[model samples]
Target chain A: MRHLASILLVLLLTIPSSPIFSQGRVLEKKQVALWFGIRDITRDSLANTGDLDFLNYLHSSDDMSEYQYLGVSAHLWFRGNWEADIKVAMYDDFAPNNLNIKAIWLPMKNLGFTAGIYTYPQLMNEFNMFHRLTDVGFFGDTDSNFRQRRVQESGLTAGLMIPFSYRWLHATAYINGGVSTLSPFTEKVTQKMINGNFKREIRYSTSHSPALFFFPEVELGADCFTFGNAMAGIRVRASWYTVNRSVDYGRVTYEWTYANPARNEVDNPAHHFSKFEFDAGFYLTW
Target chain B: MRISTDRTTRITVLISLAFLLKAVSSCIQPVFDFDFDFNKITVTNLDNSDVYVMRNDRDTMYSSAIAFEVTLSDEEFLAAGSLPKAETAFPGFTPATAMSPESLYHPRHHITALRIVTLEEMSPAIPAGSDVTGLFVAYVPRYSEGFLYIITDELLTMINRDFYPGEPSVSFQLFCNQDITASRVLFAITVTLSDESMLTAQTGIVNLLRAR
Candidate 1:
């Protein structure tokens, strides 16, 4: 993945001068046009309301926090009809464990249809240290100590992008099939008092192998306000559920893990993602 | 003027980027390592019953069993503690489950051995004297031994290794004589680690009433 990313970076730097997209309309004002689109999400990160079993399981931990992203987009100074575009999203707080980059081409301006390659890093919580945190009362002594390292299970994204921008407005429609990984939360234990001794009857733990978190979704982005080099608007994304069905993979069942037992398995009937979310944001270019 | 405006915009962008980088760096924290002790015990009441009844379930059967479940820590367990209803190690853990058994927490390194002493606290309201002393024996009942606690070494390590969930109760009942109409019996388990090294605990007196 590191080599692939390095190659992509080299390609991004050389794409503007490359013969492939070096063809475009010669502008009357300037022979070149270089603009950058920036979107900052750290200002606000509304939580992903305990939708997936994984997110809900993390709500009880002390290490839980909101993750942020700073997205950047660069449009090349290619001539008249052809242009090279690179979009990158850098994720928060950590050094640089997460990223989303897409390099696209627009054959022509207004009413243009484009294709792009997408890549993003994924994270997984194996939950190996959950028991230690839950059993902190053995000596009437409790410790607020808990921590876990996340595992990355990222995969590339494949999709079709239809971008249409007129005089003062811009919109893009996307139908993307992205791959991810999911390990539904699972653990079961029965406690008994044998001759006054508190003993545990551990019947289950999160032993099931993670299932693929692959889903197809439609996303639409539109910019309503456009000033000289910046545009502010809201984006909407619609997608089906993505949790692995109980029948397919064993259901995630437990107490003290979640509030509702009925929410043990939030699997969707149709093969889709467990998230049906709506994200509204901006696309500023300068 | 145009060049000046561009220069100012560039400066603002640089400052913003630097601040964002600072925030990200500050957020980076090393994973915490916790020192945890795993010695624990858990108790369960099968049917949530406070009173256990002697099951004749058969004509020749004079045997009985304790409804309460006392399990020692195997892999996951909460040790005996004085926790209020509002406070809990985990959710759904009530005071009934948090309170240690009779003398399970017998401070001062506890006892070298555990001895199960059975005695009748209350007897049925009758006119003549009733024999309630040796009605039943308090032992760690075993299915392999036809549900009877055979006299043997009562070491803390041995009890911890044996008593757990799904297995028969270490606090088991045997031969509830047909004569005893009603009585409150205390099957007390006494213990602490054989060697007062690190772990030490004493059993509390458990009150079980017999109902034919």
Candidate 2:
């Protein structure tokens, strides 16, 4: 934790002295902003025939409720249309922590592009693993036990951003899409016997369908106070995103008393999610 | 102007030639000549039982040679008793041993039903006492959907032997009664036992007899 704090302090001190800090014989590209916000995401779209398929086979209903998330981000602006940003956030209940970093390019004053990597936990909550203390019916009553659920790493992201302003208040809207490698949970019961040596394989079949997200943001009441060399304001933002989810399971073997011992291959179902989120937060610029 | 006219004519001729070739290719239908085999049938004992018998009542037991045959028309194959049915009552009874009549009809006795099931359908039903063993045959038709040749209880029996022990094996026979025009046929039998036993070493020969 101390190391993270020191790194943030170093970034704060060095952003102002960079060569891109000057604009038109004055400080133009130099800006350090810190932001904290609360966000809520709700699942929207599922796979084709996913609801009916799950109901007929698994005999369960799909429930989509709004989940709250708290996050912090730091932005550093440099001269010549170059900037860097980092965001870290955590969710409530079974929500996992998400971290993202991006290098942005601003060809013109109003338009920009960002490319980065993102990491977050799996959206599906495991009943046996985490919510064992809670009622089993909360996650759906199934005889199967959940053993493992882990974080998923979204390898890369590339998107475009557009910023608009009205007098002192400014609004920024962005759309980004990229391909990623996904790591699913391992269901190996003997995984511990082998000292957890089991390595989850990354699925590449869904790479053709690049994960896409659109963040159309509006900041209200942006211009207010300029304290010393720092500027602070309060704003409300809403972001909506969509992504294709691919779940892969290896080989399955089952034998019963009345049936034959069968060995077959099971593939992950293709799933898509549409999320709508709103966040209220404060941003500071210097 | 003359050069341009010649170039346009050449392009039109090439396009016409390509269309002619495609039309000719689409008109020709390739004939697929393949053989089906119905020569051998082997029933392996999946459950714990020395002798597997098709029984109707909870108390009475009967055994019969299960029969299966394939024909060209769907009506002939769907006829009742063309498949095997479990005998309901046994006339010659000697305590645990009895023989059923050759010609007897019982309400509860019927041929087992076999249908194609996906993996997801097998998930929940697998843990329960659902029989997953049977014959699987692949049949291909010219314009019709391909169907599997499956015999649920006609040629097999699932013996539950928690009450009896010793030589745990089930026996049944496959009787081919219909004339098959197909050149060759293939049959696959899958068996799952209640206990994990190394019975992979067991082997038996299937006798296929032509109907008189």
Candidate 3:
């Protein structure tokens, strides 16, 4: 805990100080800012109909419900074109938590790109959204300590931010696109079957594939009547994602053995599963 | 000094090219690796009653019956009136002539019926002074020949207790059942115990002819 506090103190002192130092340099284009906000997260699980048929069962058999959370983020900008940001968030249900690091580059005034990696110490809405639409093995309920789905995503995100001002009101409209990969923790399933006088075994393995999606963000706010060098504003944003997923439900067969006869057999082995998600968040910037 | 028309055109083209490049660079597809295997089968028993088997075979369609024996633990044979409402509920036993006798062996039929038994007499081993506190039933389905060679398929059924609009309860059960006999006889007898948690475990099949 003390080490974390020291790290945070260093970041705070350095990030704000860099902008001040740049004020004495030529062009003086550098800027540094930090903002914190709260957000709510919701998720849905992907439906597994084919699994139901093979398993000879129907019903959720587990809890699938909506969840909400509060989160905080810190961002640092430097060299007029590069920025790095980190976020920490937690949910009430299951006490889901997450930490992420992101880097962005703006080569020109109208264009920007970003990449990032993230992990969930607690449940996150983004992870839940992906699992509900793509994961078949996430069928049963799990405890908070169990790391069901922890993913690393690296993609080029580009956006154009258009600024408009009318008297006291200022608005920004942005659009972005990117591709990401979701790597599952468990990658294979093996099944053994017995039929007549033969015993057969089959194994199913899944590989990683890329998913493409688009995001458009718009915000409208106003600078509070100047209070020294400080101002406050609020913004709302939403994103829509489209991705494909494949879940391999293992193979089936009947094989008989002579030495050891196996009478008990598991009938339904595995399922191939895949879904799309739309997410929106609101934040207050100061 | 006025700006030249050629210079304005150059600026417009440069802005357009920058936007185009940004859009192209952002076009990325994420790779998703999913290692989910759905081949596992899970079974569970929710009812408190224990099941017993009188007969089970893959060769004959009329070979099995599920018997529910009620024993009085006290000296008097307690009247059936004192039992729970489930005791008086219609057993819903459709005779073999009505439908396929093999259907009785299906797990769906077993869960739906309160009791399944032939009219055969059963001996109660309780002491004369003991009152009947509980009952055990052994259910056997009459099967047609060549049933054992047939493969049984698993079925997953999701029953939402609160499926109605504005309902509160989100709890539900996934019941997994398989046909023991592949033929029309359906008299194959297998009993497995399970809970409402992770669906795992195997059922034991009893060969009645071998026992006899």
Give the winner by lDDT.
2
Interface RMSD of each: 13.0, 20.3, 14.2
Best TM-score among the predictions, by candidate number: 2
Residue A40's C-alpha lDDT in candidate 2? 39
Relative to the true structure, candidate 3 has a C-alpha RMSD (angstroms) of 30.5
lDDT of 3 by residue, B46-121 (tens): 2211121222223221112211111101112122212212222333332223422111101111111111121212
Error of 2 at A280 (Å): 1.5
Model 3 chain B weakest lDDT span, ten residues long? B103-112
B95-186 per-residue lDDT for model 2 (tens digits):
22164223212111212332322121223433322333332222111211211122344222322212111111223323221222222222
lDDT of each: 0.35, 0.39, 0.31
**If both were scored by TM-score, which would come out higher, candidate 1 or candidate 3?**
3
For model 1, residues A1-286, the per-residue Cα lDDT tens digits are 4556555555555554455543343311111122222221111112333222233232222222233344434455334444444644445542332334433444544333333444444333333234433443221111233423333334445455566656655455544455454333333333322122122323232323334443343444555666764455545443332434221223333221122332233432222224333333454432
Docking class of 3: incorrect
TM-score of chain A of 1: 0.44
Q: By summed lDDT, which 10 consecutive residues of candidate 2 chain A come out lowest?
A: A190-199
> Tens-digit lDDT track for model 3 on A183-242?
433321111111111112222222343455454555455545445443444443333433
* DockQ of prediction 1: 0.02
